[model samples]
Target chain A: MTKEELKIKIEDILPAATFDETGEWLNILIEAKAWYGFAKQIRSSRELEFDYLFCLTCIDWKTHLTMVYHFTSTYRRHTIVIKSKLDRNNPEIESVAAIWRTAEFHEREVYELFGVKFLNHPDMRKLLLTDDWSGGFPLRKDFEDPINMIRL
Target chain B: MIEEVGTTTEGDLIINIGPQHPSTHGVLHLVITLNGETIKNVEPHLGYIHRSIEKMCESLTYRQFIYVTSRMDYLSAHINNHGCALCVEKGLQIEVPPRAQVIRVLMDELTRLASHQLWWGAMGMDVGALTPFFHAFREREMINEIMEETCGARLTMNYMVPGGVMFDLHPNFQHRVKKFIEFFKSKIDEYHELLTGNMIFVNRMKGVGFLSKEDAISYGCTGPTARGSGVICDIRKLYPYEVYSQISFEEVIETGGDCLSRYLVRMEEMRQSLSIIEQLIDNIPEGDFQAKTKAVLKLPKGEFYSRVETARGEFGVYIISEGGTTPYRIKFRSPGFSNLSALNHMAKRSKIGDLIAIMGTLDLVIPDIDR
Candidate 1:
């Protein structure tokens, strides 16, 4: 499907969805409150069935956090990038693990490094970090570790 | 504390396998819950070698960061570096020369062949066949020699630069690759006779570690892992980059959706990689190896993502540039990471001995997962 047709179809399902066309794929920016609802709709929607969640990650912008979810339908073969803005101080977003099983690992990695809490995630503990780790979110912009991390 | 570690309310046995186990091949830990011989749950404990490459990339410039990627999936090092370079090229809007494009593709295929060869040997070893390991390495050594001659490194050949390759190919590159292909082709049948047709191997692999098509897609498994389940998730065919669109190679798939099917996918993939190398080994275009660019590279403010079919699966490089020398944020979507996620789902209700075969087929590289 062409990007134009996808935009038109996505518009019907998500009226409040803001589109960013500057990048490669059709980028959609939605609020954190609307992420799970929109994700569920797209997964079940007849035309825009975003069944495959290929990549899921969080970008810490220091002041706020942005969750990037790259989705594509295995059958339709078109790709889209969906983003949700979260307040960095208390970053929380609905977990899509139940919908896309791959999100279980990706979300857990994001949870530990960025300190973003995943709501209703089946397994919500540290993934790549050790149990004794107390270092503040290593991927955050303001993360400081004088001894371990080499600062440039 | 020791007693509490193993026994649950229902009297299930908990077995801890390697941060150093031979079967694991790298630093991967799994705490498996077992009831008699069947596995109830498999919980993976990672982070033993987590260097946080993403955070490290935030500090390095566009040129410096691409080299560090080879350390992640060292098996598919060239492909990982190529993916990173592709992302930077996308952001910079640089057109790689036709010759460089062909060279890059050839290197990618060779690397894929080498990676699969190593995986083949290791998979055999994991499944308790030791002789196949030596035979597999014999073919892989030729590719390593070619890599060392042309790229100056065998494993982590950081040969890819943003615009194109760091330098032109070696004088004997084509001749050596052709020689390796001919040598590998003759030994192909022998490999089948040795391992693929063995009666013990067949019984151990067939109908074990079953992964359904639905579950495979949901877990985001890619490369042979997903193609084994008949999902048609080959990034080379789905989203062709470089000279891949021009090449005529099959996206090998097997419908078994078991350990045997996954094994067949990689075995066939090695042949496809050879056909690709054969097609382009002599057809390399005559032109500049790299495009003209400034020494100090800078990317405009935007987001760029590039995907390449690595030996394990889809290796993606996502770069968020803030109009600076360094990338604001970078994320590598390693194929092994996603493929490893589906391990527990496939291994449930399977015997403990079958776990090795399942992991062998999955081809989990711990560094790629923990990176």
Candidate 2:
């Protein structure tokens, strides 16, 4: 399906979602609360069985955190990107671990690096960072490390 | 969706198999919870050698970032660098010259073949066969020699730049690659004799690691790990970049979804890589190897993603540029990371020895996973 078709299909499922059409893939901006429902729908829906969650990441805009998800159907090969904005001070979003198992790992990586709380995530722990890591979220724009002595 | 098992309970025996164990390979720490001899849960405690390449890439220029990726999946360094280059080129909206495209593809296939050869040798060593390791390295040494001549370094050559490969092919690159392919082609049959048809080796791998087609997809397994279950997850075939669409090769798939099937798929893929090298070795177009671009590359404000089939699986480079010289945020979706996520599922209910066999087939590289 073309990006137009994917946009229409996704619009039907997510009413509040807005899309940015400039990128290569169809990009949808949705609310953080709506992510779980949309995730379940896309994974199981007949027209959009986005069974593969290839890349899940969180971007720090300093003021707000934007969660990004890149999904591609195994059979159809059509890809889509979903973005949800979360308040950087209290960044929290529903985990899609139950929907796509691969999100479990990516979510953990993001949780530690970006300091985003993945609510209902199975194993929400520091993945690439150590448990005793005292430095704040390394990926955050405001994060500082006395060890590296680098300040942004 | 919580961890199925990994928590220690009463009367459970657990063992730590390396942050440095030789069998686990390359600083991978696996915490195995056991019930007598049978495995209960295999929990991987990572971050041992994590250098945070993604965090570092945010500070480096687009050209400087590609070299750092070589350290992530060192075995498939060329392909990983190729993926990053393609992403940056996509952002810049420039086409690589035909000569450079062919050279990049040739280097990619050579790297894959060399990487698979090392995996074959190391995998054999992991599973109690020592002689095949030496046999596999004997041919890999030839590929390294070619890479050393052309790229000027062995592993992690840092050969690929943004627009194209940093340098043109060496004077004897074709002759040496052709000779190596001809020599390796004859030894393919001997590989079967030494390991493929050996019953002891066959029995050790045949049905031990059973990952179902659904589980393979759910776990986001790619390359031979997914193709072993009859999934066509080859990025070269699915989303061909460069001159792959022009190339003729079959993406090898095996339906068994066992350790043997995954092993067989790589063995078959090595032959396919050779065929690809054979096809392109003679037909490298005569043109400017590098496309003209500014010395300082600043990707336009947009999100660009490019995925290339590395030796292990799909290595994707996701870049979000804010119209700056450095990427705002860069993520390297190394294949071993997702493949490692599925280890617990595959290792459960199996013996401790089978863990090695399963891991051997998965071909986990520590830096790739940790990155």
| Candidate that would win on TM-score | 1
lDDT of 2 by residue, B70-127 (tens): 9999999999999999999999988899999999999999999999998898888888
Give the alpha carbon lDDT tens digit for every residue of A55-149 in model 2: 88989988899999999998888999999999999999999988888889989999988889999999887777877887788889877666663
True lDDT of residue A11, candidate 2? 84
Q: Each model's DockQ?
A: 0.71, 0.57
TM-score of chain B of each: 0.98, 0.97
Q: After TM-score superposition, what is the CA distance of residue A49 in candidate 2 from its true location, in Å?
A: 0.6
Compare the candidates by DockQ and give the number of the best one.
Answer: 1
In CAPRI terms, model 2 is classed as: medium
Q: lDDT winner among the candidates? A: 1
In terms of lDDT, the poorest run of 10 residues in model 2 chain A is A143-152
Tens digits of per-residue lDDT, candidate 1, A1-152, equal 78899999989988899999988899999988988888999999988888899889989887799999999899898899999999989999999999999999999999999999999999998889988789889999998888886346
lDDT at A44 for candidate 2?
91
Which whole-number lDDT from 0 to 100 does residue A39 have in model 2? 88
Q: What does the lDDT come to for candidate 2? A: 0.90
Query: What would the DockQ be for model 1?
Result: 0.71
